[model samples]
Target: MFLMMGLMYFVVDLAAILLLSACWQRTRIRGFAIVAASYGAGIVARWTAPLAYRWADSGDGGMGSLAGVVVQTAFFLVAVVAVVGFWDIYRVLKQRPAA
Candidate 1:
């Protein structure tokens, strides 16, 4: 179940990275590129969470829980960065001169 959920998130994150990369390439917006990279990191962190959970349930015990916490914290931080990047992109777009 957790694995399936992680896979879903991975797919969504992959798509987001691709779209943001394309947007960045077209617009040359640093924020979009940063957000896309953050999303890439997010995919890794997100995938780690469930595996850590599974390990915690098995025998890894405290270490597994700690790993899970660390990964989740990283995921949250990446999400925050992505939000800030989006805000920067929005500001840039708003400041653009009309064509």
Candidate 2:
């Protein structure tokens, strides 16, 4: 259960990596960097989860604190940006002739 929950956190980053890989030429290093940052954000957020739960109740009140909120916000924002960029790149790659 614990391992499964932990894996769930990286779903976005993993998908972004795979998608960016598919459109490698279109995204290049920038896409990879974005995904890597997102992944890093997730790692930080998870690392801070203990403090978040301890302060923010570890109850039901969103299960987070200020630190948790900041880290989680960063993670979500970067992950979303990476995924969107990858999707757009993939679309462009599919439209053009394969290089």
In model 2, state the lDDT of residue 10. Answer: 67
**Model 1, 1-99: lDDT tens per residue?**
977987888889899999999999999988999899899888777666667777777874667768767777888899898988889898998999988
The 0-to-1 C-alpha lDDT of every candidate, in the order given, reads 0.84, 0.63
What TM-score does structure 2 among the candidates reach? 0.46
Model 1: CA > 4 A from native: 54-68
**What lDDT is reached at residue 17 by model 1?**
92
Off by over 4 Å in 2: 1-29, 58-75, 91-96
lDDT measured at residue 57 in model 1 versus the true structure, 0 to 100: 73
TM-score of each: 0.73, 0.46
Residue-level lDDT for 95 in candidate 2:
76
Candidate 2 colliding pairs: none
What is the per-residue lDDT of model 2 for residues 1-99, given as tens digits with 9 covering 90 to 100?
976877776675567556645555455645555555556656666756666657777567765556566666766786697696566656656777877
Evaluated with lDDT, which candidate comes out highest?
1
Between which residue pairs do clashes occur in model 1?
none
Candidate 1: lDDT over CA atoms? 0.84
